[model samples]
Target: MQNFESLNLFAPLEKALRELNYQTPTPIQAKAIPPAIEGMDILGCASTGTGKTAAFAIPILDFLGNEKPRTRAYHPTVLILAPTRELVIQIADSFGDYGKHMKFRQTLVYGGIRQDSQVKSLKHGTDVLIATPGRLMDLMEQGKVKFDDIQIFVLDEADRMLDMGFLPALRKIVAKLPEDRQSMFFSATLSPTIRELAATFLFNPISVTVPSKALTADGVKQSVRYVQRDEKVNALHSYLSSDKVDRTIVFTRTKHGANNLVKKLERQGIVALAIHGNKSQGARQRALDAFRDNKIKTLVATDVAARGIDIEGVTHVVNFDMPVEPESYVHRVGRTGRAGAKGIAISYCTSAETKELKAIEKLIGFDLRVENPKFKFGESAPAAKGGKSASGKSQGSRRKNKSYKPHWQMKGRNKRRSKTASA
Candidate 1:
């Protein structure tokens, strides 16, 4: 459909869309919304930043806004289960924006904060509940939450929940919900495991898949740089200092690594922050708020922590550490290039990570353009053959025997030589 008006959404939701200046339905939104509004179970496969939040949110709001009052005390009519606290908050906020003109009530509950407020909100009851799996289960067991009144259930980021080993919890959550409810499952990629879970939960679901050239968003420009492991920080520093990088997210593999990188960047006079599993919810929210407000130029995060983040205007995404799972590369780069805005994804791959890079290429069905320190953009790196570079050097040999050094380190060495000569 060309516009929100064409979708026949509730007038209030249409008004909200007009106020927000939403002109067109994304591919996923276009296909998913129609079936969803018809009260059909929907299984949607679309990447992040494709307006997936609104794809499901808009229809759910419309359904609730028009339907008669079925809401019961301490029981929500609609339940949304996401994988992360950040995403739970994002989804709740989206509902709030779309349902502003309606009187339907919604509240988000997640871990890492005192549950007193959430408990109080639950005691009074709400029309909708957005929550992470763990917190939702905790409340369910304590009798503070119930799914008997739910008419609609949504599982957002199903692949991510599976990756985080929440399948068991999901099974428990699904078991608790009434079998006679509309179901919706959304994920960036659909693996066999995800399909199996969908089958177990959804009944005769209408499937919607928006296929792309690659798993990531079309607006993102992806590239990789082969550098020594120790030089990644320096490469990131250089990239952040460039004018092209405005509002960036640097993904690391570990919480400690993210914190350390933030410290190193701060030492260099860069205003950066880190948000990971280790940070308190308040701190993570603070960092996210600062990033959204443009008060911070860089936000370092781990893959799990970054999953639910939906900040806009991020021009660059730096993979300070390559993800072990190839699918994660798609998610990492997705942080940028959202909503038709151009985005750049730069990955720092060390010789040790050739295998990881190859796995990513195999999954994405294309080789990423390789850029060395001396070259802004170069030809695609030849695929590693049998854990060896195309040049017939073993991965270990490339890491240990290659004599090439980073330009910045060489420059420092040259400065030392000049100082000795002058002395």
Candidate 2:
């Protein structure tokens, strides 16, 4: 469908769409909504930020609206499973936005917080239940939730579920879902393993595939800066110092790395926060709120922690650590350049990370331009092929300068660098 109006959604949904200024349907939405509204199972392949939330949410809302659900405690008519708490929350927000004019009760269930409120919310009756796998499993084991009344089952970020080792939990959850319910499976990639898993859940499903380019939005300008392992923090600080950067998310490979990076940035006088599995839900939420409100312009996060975060006005994404998984590179960069807005993705790579960089390049089908830092921090050394530095200095000169200390190490350097490090 060219527009949401052509989809023939419920009256309230159409009204909500108009108010939200959602005119044209995204590729996944255009292909998935019609069949979904017709009660057919959908197997959709699309990346984050492609409006897939609306693709499945709208049809589910339409179904709930058309057929007034018989509310029952612990029985949700729609069960949407996402890989992370942020994504579950994001999906719930989308549902609320799209179904604002329609009356529906939805509850979010996730771990890292007391379950008292979530349990009470479930007992009070809800039309939709959005949750992460681990918490949902706990609730199921405790007999606080049920799948008997589920009319629609949605498994979003299916590939991520596998990456996080949620297959066993997924199978158990799917077993509880009624066979009569309509199912929808969405993932960034439709690999053989994902397809095999989807076959078990969906019957003769309609497959909707968004083009591969959608995974890496066209508006993002991607580049890499080769820095020594010890100088990564300084290199990142320099980039954050640039006036071009606004709201940014810096991805790290480990939770400890994320925390350390935040501390380093703070030492540089750049107020930043870290989010990872180690953080309490309250802490993560607070960090996210600060970022969304621009109270803090930068957030350092691990790959899993930052998954499913859909925020606007993110002008740049920095990779503080190269991700071992190429798929994660796509996810990290996808955080920016959303909603047709321009974005920049910069990665810091050391000599040891060249293998990971090559893997990422092979996956993206292109090479990232090696950007020379304005103030070199020992990244000018020649690679295997050998080349001169950006300053026309010989490889030998670049080597001789490797021991050269930058402003970060000088007696009065940090104080001076702090002035230029404000992000």
> lDDT, candidate 1, residue 124?
81
Tens-digit lDDT string for candidate 1 (216-297): 7668889998875555676688889988678899999999999889988887678899998779899999999999999998
RMSD of each: 9.5, 8.3
Residue 202 lDDT in candidate 2: 99
**Residue ranges of candidate 1 with Cα displaced over 4 Å:** 212-219, 373-423
Best-fitting candidate, scored by TM-score:
2
Worst-scoring 10-residue span by lDDT in model 1:
375-384
Q: Clash pairs of candidate 2? A: none
What is the per-residue lDDT of model 2 for residues 63-83, given as tens digits with 9 covering 90 to 100? 988898898999999999998
Give the Å shift of residue 132 in candidate 2. Answer: 0.7
